[model samples]
Each structure stands twice: as structure tokens, then as C-alpha cells.
Target: MIGDAWLWVAVEWSPPSYGLPFTDQEFDTPTTVALVVAAVVKAAFLWLILRAPAPGPMDRRTKALRRLLYLTVAYDLVLWYPLALLLDTVVAAFDLALWTSLNVLFLLVIRWRSRALRATAGTMFALELAGMADALLDELDLPELGSNDAVGFVLALGGAAAIVLTVVGQRRDGRWSRGTLVAGWAFVGSFALMISVVALADMLFSGGLVEGIALDALGLVPAVWLAATARELPTDIGPADRPPARRRELRVAMAAVALLPIVALVHPEQSAHHSFTGASPPCYDQPHFGDLKPSERDAAFLCQARIRYSGVPPIFPDTLPDQAVLAYGRALCRAKDREEEREILTRAGSERPDSGMDPWDLVYVCPEVVGATRPELLRSAEEQKAANDAYIAEANARCRDPWPRTKGVAQATANYFLFVDGDPGYLVQDPGDKAAEQAAGLAMDRVYDDDTLIGVGGSAVLVGHVEDVSDLCLTVKAFRAAPPRRVAGWDYVNEVPIVSRSGQLTVPEMDGGDVGAGAPMPNLAIRGKGRYRLRVYVRADDSGEQHLVVVFPGASRKRLQLKP
Candidate 1:
């Protein structure tokens, strides 16, 4: 029942923006349910602590563990009440600090209980502390001392060794009481169970529901068992003070319990998020961007793009004249000055000697002047109507609808799609290595060459870790041939590049691969015999008084052969 309830809590949690969807508190049903569950867990913890047998004369470890229990209950109470209810930066910091302290205290108790368990707990605890330091560095914008993955690897190896030692030692020595054994095992087992459930659940769901519920259950069950079972052997007169018989069953149970920590330590990498260090590669100067999850990349992209295009001094010093012209044209269109918009745009088109600006881009800049002077721009009134409707449909789909836009860009473009998060500030392309180039070209060609090929692949650039929002823009581009029309379409429409607005691309979490999780793009379509070229551009817009920024690498005109 507890486990299932935990799953519900996970589903209903108001996790941070990076974790999952549905972060708004307006949908308070799940939070309310979680609160109820938390209350139950807290009550159980308190009951166990209060009802447990008091420590006898010289059970120092027992006394220490009892004190830890009281502290834990206090911490949980704080988490349950006003602290949990009020979410703020300070609250988050307090929560993190309390959580770390609790874990550390628990480890100290384990170390105090038995010399055999000490080494195991000590090693893991030390690693945990280091991981915490790394996390702290990331949070404070300090250089990372080491990678979390490395720390996890070491912890896993050491934990496996510890487990073997503990089980072997238990099998040989039987001095521990059944109650003590239960408490000891429960100490490790509960934490392991929570960790395992959370890791497995992450695989199945993006939301934090599964993990949250399990955490509550984990926090209570073992503590209850410990309190109920805690009974020190009486140390009184003569023979009465002798220890209880060591049971074979209890030893076996201890052995089984020893296995639990191994499970917890198995995949330490996943725990990296809980750790202090940012998981981003050491290449990027700033840890801020590295901390952001792929789900929240859209917002990061928009924030960065706006800065780059603002023509702010020292950031983007040289604004392209063409981009400036396009920005002006867009402003004129917005102000309902269609005549001036057309004249300026038309004159700009005629006079600007091979301006990098494309006709399709100009249309977006001045959509109101669609029919006045550019009759050739649309095939007919019906085509114009379709285009206008498509424009509206695209806007509505991007603004209001969820994934898989109204007319899937992937489908409309015959799988060729391009979604860019404008641009941050810099540019660097793949300096073609023969082996890598051949591989990328072959991958692209294979899809275009074979009729049996339904899947497509393209080149990806994972430029290590980005520090600030300004460090990078999420760019995803795919090109498709314009649908054949009787009237000449806008020149750039032949290779229409669609840009993804903020909050559009929701790729899976990056695994710290070489490509570093580039923005996702649609598949490249191969329908006709003509060879294709890929290009990228930077453009600016004036959308609702915000300076628009679009900086992207142009695709190489190096044509990929259609034939195999």
C-alpha cells in the first residue's frame, strides 16, 4: 500500500522545472495527496522512536543511534510543515542541508554499531561527502574537482567489496542480537530500497511520482521496525547478564541485509543529480547551462537568443545590416504601414547586392504585403489562403498545442525539419575529418539511396558543456523541397527551414556522450533525384518589443549524391 501510494505521490509531485511536466501548484490534488502520505510516514516514525526501548547503561552506540532518530524525526517534521509548504531558495537549501546531515548521521550510527560495518559505511560516506563537494562547486560556479561518474564508479566498486566482507564476517561471527541485527539491516535496506525504486521508476516515467511515494514509505518502515525490535541484553547479576544465543536465522538475515547496500551503490551515476556536482563535461566554463535538463532547454535557448540579438555592447558587437533591415521591415508590418513595408522590402531586395536575406524570410518580416506587389510570391489566391491558414495553424500548434504540431512539420516537410533555438553568440563547425565526414555522408546517403530505408540519420555536434545561456543556442534544422506550385514560391521556401520556438524540443536526458545532446531535428527526406544542400543563417526579429536573435551555422553546400 505504501509503495503504491508513493507512486501516486510521484505522479502528482510539483517537481522542479527541469524534472517533469505539470509543475504548476494550481493543480494541487497531487500535492495534497503527498502531504497526506507524508503525515502518515511522520506519524509512523514518531511512534517507533517514542515506543522503542530506552538505551541501557553503557550502550553508547545505541544511545547515539537514538539521538540520531530524534534528529531525523525533527528534520522530517520540518520538511512536512511550513518548510515543505513554502517553496523558496532558502527552503530548498535547508532541505538539501538537512537531507545530507541525515544521511551522514545514519552512516555515523552504522560506523558506531560494529567495527566490521565501519569500513563499508566509512568508505561510502567519504565518497558521498566528496560527491557533495562537487555538487557544491557546481552550484557556486566553481571549477569541478572531479566528475560524479568517477566518484560513483569508485563507490560501486568499494560497496561491492564491503558487502562481501560484511556477509562473510556475519557468517563467521554470531554475537549480534536478533533485534540489533534487524535494526542494522533495516538501516541499510530501507535506503537501498528507496534508491532502487527511484532509479527503476525514472526509466519508466519522467515525472517524480514513483520515487516520491517510495521515499515516504522507505523513511518510515525500517525506523518502525527498529524501534519495535530494539531491546538491549540485560547486564545485571552473574549468569543473568550473559548474552542471548546467536541464531543461525538471524545471521542469514544479516547476510541478506548486507546485499541491499550493493543495490544502492550499483548505479551511482544516476545519483549524480542528487550529488552536488553538475554532470556537464568539464569543457564548458559555466556550470549553469550544464545543470539544466533537456526538457528545460527551450527556455534557456530563448533567454540566450534574446541577449545575442539585442545588439548589446561587448556581446554582439557587429549586427548584420541585412538582419537590421529585416527587423525594421517586421516593425513596419506590425505598425500597419503595409505600403512603406512593401516599398522598403522591395527596394531592399532589388538594391542589396546578393544580400544573404531570402525572399521567404522577407515574407515573414512583412506578411501583410503578401499580395500588393509580390503577386509572383503566391501561386494563386487559393494558395495564398492556404499559406495564411498554415501560418495560423503553425502559430496555434506551436503556442497552444503539445508535441507533434497540428500538421507535423516532419510529415509536411517529408521528414525534413529544422528547429533552432535562435542562437547564443558563437559559431564553430565540424572541421571535416575524412573518417567522420565519410561516416556522416554515408549515413545521410543511405537513407536517400535506398527505397527500403525508412529511418534517417545526420551529423551531431556535442560541444561539451555550456556555462551560461549565452554559451549556446539549441539549433535543430532539416530541409525539405518546397511542394511544387504553379506560381513561383518564395526563393528560400525551396529549402524551408523551420525554427522551433521556446519550449518545443523535448529530447531525452543526455548521457554525457560526445555529441552532448544537441537539439533534436526532423528526419531528412529523400523523394526525388535532385541532390540537396544544407545551409544555416542568422536572422533577427522584433517580436513584441523583444529584440529577436537568430544565430546559426549555415549548412555546407556540399551536395549529398541521391544515387547509392
Candidate 2:
């Protein structure tokens, strides 16, 4: 029954995942099988023992053996299980070491009760420890016989030996001598001390001080119980007096010893490396990437390849300035003999002294290159009104709205300039009272959901308003002349899209502004050299017809014509 219980507990506590190379699902079946087999074997052994004749009345030897078995079982249940399994997360390494130590101690106790059982139990324990060491060494990639591993092994073996000596003396002398008593106490003390040291070392290296201390305190209970119980067994009994119970007691001890090797054989090994040389398999014999099949290799490569960007900017920063977008644009213009496009690029490049022509020609500009401005100052009332009037006239010209009333109407315009061939630059305009501002705020909030989206920018124009509109006309012409769908490679380049929030649009606070020549809004470029998509959310004070026009270099103008 005790063996059955221990087996069940071991299966529950460690499961197969504890040290095996099986997936999670595999553990369930194997664990159930192992536990059932162990229980059946243990039950059979117990039945046989009960049927056997009592060797004799229980003698001192028999009593001592019984006490040792009880102690070992109690220690394993109370100390080893909780510390190793229950408190694994906080002090996994420490718990493992302590559990290993307890196993050694338990084997030694069994050996003392029945020397004939030693060959089996000792060999099993040794092999199990060897396997554990092998796994640890492989996992940690440590040097052989490192200080920690050597000390731990010595402590465990020494503790086991001490228990054996104490048990042997009691059997021979009928009572424990003062020296034996002291040694027994010292063994318990040393065990506790070693556990404390291991816990503390784990705490210092890893960060679980509170858990280490708690587990150490819990470990003391079993140590005390074992020492006190083992000390009570009588030291002597005559052969005739012990005959009745001796057979059963010895049989139980032998069964325990035999079970060890069986358990060891069935125990799946962990893929850990031990610090000891003899504990591990040779490196060349271990599995490696090359051992994977062709299918696996193909799958791995495909998984990596899907995320590669063909023309998109590298996500990470580069030491050399990013110039892909500007260079691509310039090369395209030069190939097409577009002198005006080349001159525009050259002028923007020359303005920045340090970078010379490099900044303007780069695929994208660093956000730092664009000077900071108050978000409010990006547009003014007069500029906004004139732009709105021109937009309305243009819209009216396109679609005849006989009864147009533009009051309380939201308006906005967004323009995107791309130097390569892909998605053309986009623009959005809201023209209804203060609705545009609300729309922009909502859009900004959405873009910044993940803390990644930055600001937006583009030229704001009032169509069909100015009598002498050479400057405004030139700005539009210049925008129309640039190549389409091409990007400027600059620092901090990213692709961002404006997504609208749900529900009716609400107008936010708006300080009406007019955008005109020499206004900061026209020149207020953020990260000056990169292509951008501008979104304008606005409401016209009075409505006739509102036009949100998006002009791209060398592409037809996209006009969002609306009337309110």
C-alpha cells in the first residue's frame, strides 16, 4: 500500500513532463500505465508477505527496520514532495537537488535494513542519479564536475552513508552509543544545512528569496520527524523471537529495493546536462538542426520567408542613413529626364548643410529632421476659410448643387505622395462645422492604440480663390510633377493608415485658421524629407460646396467632392 501510494504521488507530482522528452499528451497515457503497474506489483508483494509465516515475534532488528521505513516514507511525503513539486516555480533547481538528496537518503536507509537489497537499490539509485546528472549537464552546458554538482553529490552520498552506519550499529549493538547518537543527529543537521545552502544559492542566483526560505522551513519538519523516530527503535532481538515477523519485514524491504531498478529502467530521461563528465552522453551523439527532415526544413524556411519585406523599410535602425526612397525617386526622374523633379530634390537636399543633398534624396527622413510645432498652429482661420471657399467652388464646378448651404458642415483633406508604384498617397477631408476636428481626434486615437502611430502632414490648398495664385499654383504643380507610389528611405519610416472610429462624428474644439503663403503650416513639415498622407478634419463656418482634393506627383488628382 505504501509503495502504491508513493508511486501514485510520484506520478502526480512529476508527471512525465518532469524530465521526459514526450509531448504533454503522451504523459497522460504513460503515467497511468506506470502507476497501475506499480500498484499491482506492490499489491502482489504485500499479499505474498501476509501469507508467509511470521518469522518470529518482532525483534529489535525488525522494529528498527520498520521504524526506518516509516521515517523514509514520512520524509519523502512531507519534505520531498511539497518542496520539489509544490514549490517548483520559485525554487525549481533547489527543489530538484533536495529531492535527489532525499532519494539517496531513502535508499541508504533501505540498505541498512536489508544488506541483500543493496545491490539492486544501490545500482538503481546510481543509474538514476547518473541520468539526472546527464540531463542537467546537457541543458546547462556546464563544465564537468563543477563545484556545485560535486558538492551536491558528496553531500547526498555522505548523508546516505551516515544513515546506513547508524542503522547498522543499532542492529549489531542492541542500542545506540552516544557516538552513534551524535552522528545520527549530525546527519540530520547536515541534511538540513545542505538544503539551506542549496536554497540560498538558488535564491542568490535566481530571485526567489521568500520562496526559498519558506520551502526550507517546510523541509525541517520531515528531518526532525525522521531523526526522532529512527532513534526509538530497540537495538537488539534474539533470532528465535524475531523469526515470526522477520520474513515479512525482509520481504517488504526487498520489494522496495527491487522496485527501484524497475522504476529506473522505465523512467524517461530528461534532456539536461550534468556538470559531471560520466553523467552525460557524448556531444556528437546528441540531436542537432541537421538531423531534422527535409519537410521540417522547408516549413521552417517558409515561416521565416513570409515576413521578409521586399521594398518596405527595415524595421530596425541602420548606421548608414536611409536613402532608398529618395534615391529611387531621383533615379526615376533622371531616367525620365524630368529636370524640374531633379531640381526640387536637389534644392531640398542642399538646404540641410550637414547631410548636403543626402537628406532630400533619402527614401525617408528622420522624424527629428522635422522641427516641432504646436498641433494647433498647423492651420489658421483665414487660411482654412479661403481653402474651404476654393474647395467649394471646385466642387460646385464639378457637380452643380443648385441649393447649397455649407453651414455647420465638416470638411477635411488628406494627401499622400509616393515615389514608387504601389498604393497611391491618400487624403481625407471633413467639412461640417467642427466635425473634422472630432474625426481627426478619433483617427489619431485609433492610430495610437498601440503607441506606434505618429503624426500626419501634407499641403492644404484653397482651389479657385486667389486672383494671382502663382505660388499656390506652383505648389500644386510641384506636387503633380513628383513620381507616384515611390517612397523616400529615411530614418524611422513606417506605413500608417487612417481608420475612422464608429458612430456619428462629433466636432472637437477648433480655432479657425486660414492657410496662405509664408504661413508656417505650408512649411511646417515633420521629418521633412519623407512622403506623407495628410488628413484634414474640418467644418465650414458657412456651406456652399466643399472639395477635398488629393494631388499626387505625376498622377491624376483625387477629389472628394461633397455639398452641405
Candidate 3:
């Protein structure tokens, strides 16, 4: 019941991301609305549970079923009230970490003897797995181990163990009754269908509220299917004296039903994957890619050209792979594609969405992670400290002096200033930023509520309301102190914390281009990059917009860091 949307409406709340990455992109209108709709859906779930037919009698199996059903429903409805009441107004994020902890608790029933409960629990576990399906699939597809490989491997094993135990427990309980078989099939089968349907839906759509609702609506199918079929589920094993003759037929039918979703989901996803990465027609999709080429039999395929490539007419090189790893110790930008590594020409898919790892992680001093291929790659981690120092030192040699510096924050204008990466190369060549397209023409509250306007990934558009597609100049500033409650002759737009660890601010993501006001490094000289506060103040004049930001020092607290 309590999420950013509800709280924003209730208390005018906003996410504390400021200009930092990760925490940005949250509490958005679509997210909030989806949460609201989910709360309503969960409430509807409770009602539907009540509406579900009452149990036939009280057996160990029936008791176990009700135990889980009632207890989970209770916890789902009740667990958040205290958190919202006592803690700050941020909803606990929904991600792998939270899901792992919650599902791990279900292992308590591993010792229980009810096959029906195990089946249901196994089915419930599917909920989290479905959320993580693409991530798991992507990790499974990795040519070599990526950062999250361990977590993914462990979770896969843990979930498999829990499910296996359920099947083992069922086997130990007498021979399989037809009723037991039906119930087991129903529980597991429905979830299998749900996983495929939901995951495929994700691959197909990004229309925020509509996509979310459509996914949730698909969930009702499996849930209601399980409930409707619940009466036939008998936890007790063993055959009746006059068992039906056509047992094999029933098994095949359930197997077919369970496999239906997998086929439905994977076919489209694999097709889209081929379409996007290989520059094939994005089968079963509306137009998003640009370079559409005619394929066999009048079919069309689309190719991608990166926004940040340096070229005349031809934008991207074919060798530019989809992902890269900046091995700082080796001082190399290694392509993630195994084919690229072996000099075998092939294409790979983009980084999976909702995966915690970014396409570029901590990438201020590195070259284009995707495009570059270094002969000297995969060096030792021990060189990391020395390599970073040498890299920065070399950058210092290759840079110009007195990168853009501005002071005295607190302004009264309409320009929304931003914080971005300050790579020595970027400092020397201040290419313009492509601030988030979604943030354009929105209110200040909407910007802070939705984006980490104060932080830098690749310089994104600072959220500002505008009339037409007119061009504007942007500026950057850093602070080491907190802004005073009331500042002199300036209207406060927003303020949030920014932390610097390597004694440098990140440059916004950009390739070579002449931005009106190139994103130059701000000369905020200090001992090293440490945690600091950034206060954003704006004013609207055609005067280069240099003083759009101010920096304050020292932050009291750091907000939660969300991950996949």
C-alpha cells in the first residue's frame, strides 16, 4: 500500500538520488501508478482467496495449504505498515536481494510432508524467478563469467534445491494418486505458464502503466487457475484400487500445458534478440530501430547506430560489440563478446534490462568500453591502484588547464543545471550531453522525483520545461557543504548528495560533438573526491547559463542504493 506514488501523493515525497546513479530512475509516475494498481490487485487477491471454494475437510495436506495461504496473505497485507510509520518515507525496493531473502525463508518447509504445499511453494518461487528470468537467461548466455555470475549461480542452485526437495518429499509420501498428480501438475504447470507469459510480455512492451498492468493481468491467469484446480490436489500419495486406465494420456496433457508458455515466450524473445543484435527485423515488434533493411520475402530488419560515434555519414563500426569491460588493472577496454575476443565475426545482444550491472561501470578514465580492443588485456587486479593513478596522471598531461569553474550558487532562473563525469578527456573536450529524453519539459518536482538530476552517468538532459525543441546551454558545479535554508537572491530548485571516491566527478556519457556549451570539467580542487552535497539553483537568462549549480560540502547521510 505504501510506495513512492502513494507517499508522493500523501507527503509530497521524492527519491533521494540527487545526481547519483542507481537511485535515480525511481518513484516515477508509472512506477507509482503501477504500485497503486498492484496494491489494488493484491487487495483483489485477498478477496479472491476468500471467494475461492472452501476446503472439503481438514487433512494434514489441507491444513498445510491453508496455513501457507492464510499466513502469506496476512504477511503480504500487514508487513509494511510499521516500516512506513516508523522509518523514512521510502518504500523498500523490489529487487533480487529482497526476493532472495524472502524466498529463502520458505526453506523452513523443506522438512514438511505435504506434497501439495511443496508444489504450491515451488509455484510461488516462480514469482521471483519470473522477475529475474531475463537476467538468468542473460547470465546463462554470457560467453564468460560476468560480475553477478556468483549470485546468479547460487540463487539458481538454491531455488532448484528447494523445488527438488518438494518433489522428493512428495515421492516419499505413498504412491502418486491421480488427485495428487492433478494438483501437483496444476500448481507447477500454471506457474510455468505464468513465467513464460510474463517474461515474454516484458520483452514485447515498454509502455509503462499499460505494460505493467498487462503483466499483472497475466498473473491472474495462473493464480486463478491454481485456485480453481485446488480441490483436486491431494497431498497424500498412493494409487486407488481401480485406477483409471488412461494415466499416460493425463501426464502428456499436463506436460503439454506446462510447456506451452515456454514455447510462447522463448520464440518471441529469441526472435527479438536476433532482430536487435544481428540487425534483423525485430519480429513481433513495432518500429524502434532505424536501419531497416529488406530481408527474405519482403521482411524488414533494423540496425542500430549509436548516438555517440565519431564519423561523417557512417556512424557505427560493425566491430563495435554490444558490451565491454574496462579492466583498469590491464588498462584495457575488453569486449565482452567471445567472438570479438577470438576475432570471429558475430553479433551479440545488448545488456539485459533490470540487470544490476551497467554497460559501463565506474568509467571516467577508460576509453569507449564497447569499441576499443587492446592487445594488452586481462592484467592482474593488484595493479588496480597503480593503474588508476597512472591513468589519471597521463590524463593530466593530455588535458588543458582551468576547466570551467563557477561559484556562488543560489539562482533564480528556469535553467536546470546538472552534474556529470569529469574524465580528463571530457574535461579537455566538453561534448554536449543527451540528458534523458523522458525528463524533457517536465516540472522541477517531476525531474527530482523521477531522475537523478544532480548526478552524472553520461550527461543526460537536465529536466526542464520548454515550449519548443529549441537549443539551450547547460553548466555543472560541485559543492562540499550543505546549502543554507534561505540563500541570497536565489530560488532553490532541489538539493541532494553526491559522493566522489577517486577524487573525481564522473563525466556524462558523450562522444565527440560540438555541444553549444561543451561539458567542461569544473575545477573543484580538493584533497580527493569525498562525499559532498550538491544544491541545484536555476535562473533563466540567455547568458550562457554558467552559474546554474552550486556545491556544498559534507553530507549527514547516504540513501539506499538499489540494485537488481
Q: Write the residue-wise lDDT of candidate 1 on 1-564 in tens digits.
A: 344344444443432443334543333456457656766666655665566454446354446555554555555534455665553444545544553453443332232335446445545544544444444445433345455667655644444444333333332334334554555566556656655665576575446444454465566655454344333322220221213463344334443343343233333332222211112122222113224443333333222212322223211112223234435445444544445545554444433222223333334334346435665453444565566556444532332111122232241211111123522222111223234444334444443342322112233111111122322223333224322222221111111121221212112212322122222333332222222233222212221111111112233433222222
Question: In order, what is each prediction's RMSD in angstroms?
Answer: 22.8, 23.3, 23.4
* Model 2, TM vs. native: 0.24
* Global fold similarity of model 1 (TM-score): 0.31
Candidate that beats the other on TM-score, 1 or 3, i.e. the better one: 1
Candidate that would win on TM-score: 1
- How big is the positional error of residue 429 in model 3, measured in Å on the Cα after superposition? 21
lDDT of 1: 0.37
Taking all chains together, each candidate's TM-score versus the true structure is 0.31, 0.24, 0.24
Q: For model 2, how does the per-residue alpha-carbon lDDT over 1-564 read when each residue is reduced to its tens digit?
A: 344335544533443334344332233454446555544544443342233222334545445555554545454545556555442333434433544554444443332444544444454455445444544543333332324667556636644554554444344444444544554555556566665667577555444223333343344343443444344433343333224557577546544543453344332233222221212222232122233343233222212212223443221112212233233334433332346545543544422122222221121122123113222222344554566666644532443221123211222221211123321122232233245556444544443333223332112221221122211111111122222322222112223222222212111111232222221112212123333333222222222212222222222233222211
Off by over 4 Å in 2: 1-37, 44-72, 78-153, 175-564
Query: lDDT of each model, Cα atoms only?
Result: 0.37, 0.35, 0.36
lDDT preference between candidates 2 and 3, better one = 3
In angstroms, give how far residue 164 of model 2 lies from its true place. 3.6
